[model samples]
Target: MPVHFSLDEYRTRVARTVKAMAAADLDGLLIFAPESQYWLCGYDTFGFAMFQCLVLSGDGDLHLLTRAPDLRQAQQTSTLSDAQIQIWRDLEGVRPADQLQDLLAELGLTGKRLGIETKTPGLTAYNGDMVRDALKTERLVEASDLIAGLRRVKSPAELDCIRRAAALSDDALDAALAATRAGVSEGDILADMQGAVFRGGGDYAGNEFIIGSGEAALLCRYQSGRRVLDPQDQLTLEWSGAWRRYHAAMMRTLVIGKANDIQRRMHDAAVEALEACEAAIKPGAPMGDVFDAHARVFDAHGLTHARLNACGYGMGIAYNPIWVEFPMFYEGNPMIMEPGNAFFLHMILMDSENGLAMCWGHSTILSPTGVERLSKHTLDLVEL
Candidate 1:
């Protein structure tokens, strides 16, 4: 069953967002992308090419302007019961600029600081120039970072959904490992993994399942192919499960037969790096410290050259949500690890000579004392 968040909870979240917007001195925000719309109103809609916008005023009023076909669907999914929904008739004739002008007039904001999601609208056919000319307002500013800062912290209900997603992913991966064997094709293993996720009541995988065998595993993100597995081949499987749009990812490597000394050494290094990264994920700890810990592990194993691919990202309602990868691996990101911040710490190692080795794990909640590992699956290398 799909978990439903309370209307009051959503309303409170929107209120907090609105307060933040007001503090940023923005009179209104225009959200056109799927992720922003879902974040603001808990509503997901199709037909993004149709030029839709959800206008959120500083005074806490919500108005959705979209094409005719999406009104019912938006209303059904939206948590704001009293939000007004409007529609435009034709793409060129209805003029998003003119409609936005009228919306601004209705909200009585003729000369106010208007904020726009520059990243989202920039990808679409809607011209900001047309809207600026129509409204005669020059207060449009980029609000991507501001919105992202607001969404970095997750609520308790959101964390629960993520935990469930992680559990399902762990279960599916265990089943996939059991089904893998010496004679199984890479494609067959991927198909079985997907089936396991579905049987566990998951809606979808966060990304495509990767089943790379032998030389194919040399690629960090090798996709599944028709090649049959051999007794001496090494296999790597990367996949995740989704529940109510939240994602939980897991990756594992296995040897069909006994692993060579080089493979075992690489695998051990990856496991140690993964453990070090996981240990550094407590509240108030610098995120850079976690990355540095992994880097040291790779260095200790004389695998510093392979450290470029050693990192992970944030996970959540990924398909239609913004600000998923918070505290990313960039220089000078001083965001501290908070209790509700979910992150994945992946230690991926690949060499042209030895093949691929990876250790992936995640934590949905970072407590004051320690962190909670969302997926409970063992990290040991499986022998088929």
Candidate 2:
């Protein structure tokens, strides 16, 4: 098996998950989240875009029900034996959920109270409905947060992967900074950045690197077109370095030439907010308090109108479409920060009134002593 963690580590994870399932009063769990599956047994695959499920019984038995294509995928990447992996045929009237039901019957889990992960990209509504229809006789409850909560705190091995990813993130940023200048195309900067990560033995990021210039610099998400940098232009970038499916993300808004007064003020505010957030993110602190600190700093600087509602979120063991994880920093979130918790906190300021954007962000791991900023880059404004 190409499992990254030791057999003992995988066993411990399975034990903890089984304990959580017991606490939830579930007889078994239908884990649909690819991240959850990967965390549990190193079952890595994008095949989750289709119908695939990992059934974890109360006694800690794992059985993966997937399509034919992922049979070898699981065999090569996961710790599962060939017999433990059940192939669900794609016949005209057949549904994977029905195969899951049969597998459950063989495992004697039919009609038992089951927990289903319904809030992931791996489980679309169409498939969810089919699952409900197939397992109608069984008592199913939503249990997405069980694994999510457990995965929030990184293990030592997981942190090592994230630390390497963080270094790659810094390297990518340095490459992008060196490649960025007047007359340069966004494509060239992107190529340099991604190439830096790949050259460092990093994996593809969970999502496309967000790159925009000029007016589009205000965008926080990736969009379709690309453009060259003007002599005096603004560029915003949001990217992550992934290793072993774990991500460490960073965000920045760079000025091609000299930064205007408004942009300078916004950058200062972003830096201040980011620092304040860093100070607030510690063991025993509620995640909401961190966001509150960010809000107060930005509002104090008269940049409340330009600030993002949420400051950041946990990042690790991610898949396509996004790298954001649980314990999101927002108002009234009571999730407490604990040691080994890794998160990416981005302070973004998009001033539509002035048609400018400024941002500062990096990943950090919370330790018992204090917050450990992953990126080695300074917060100074990058003026190319």
Give per-residue CA lDDT, model 1, range 150-190, as digits (tens).
66677888788778888877877777778778888777777
What RMSD value applies to candidate 1? 3.0
Kindly report which residue pairs in candidate 1 clash with one another. none
Off by over 4 Å in 2: none
lDDT of each: 0.71, 0.93
The 10 consecutive residues of candidate 2 with the worst lDDT sum are: 90-99
Note the clash tally of each candidate. 0, 0
Clashing pairs in 2: none
For candidate 2, write residues 38-106 as lDDT tens digits: 999999999999999999999999999999999999998989999899998888878888888899999
- Residue-level lDDT for 365 in candidate 1: 62
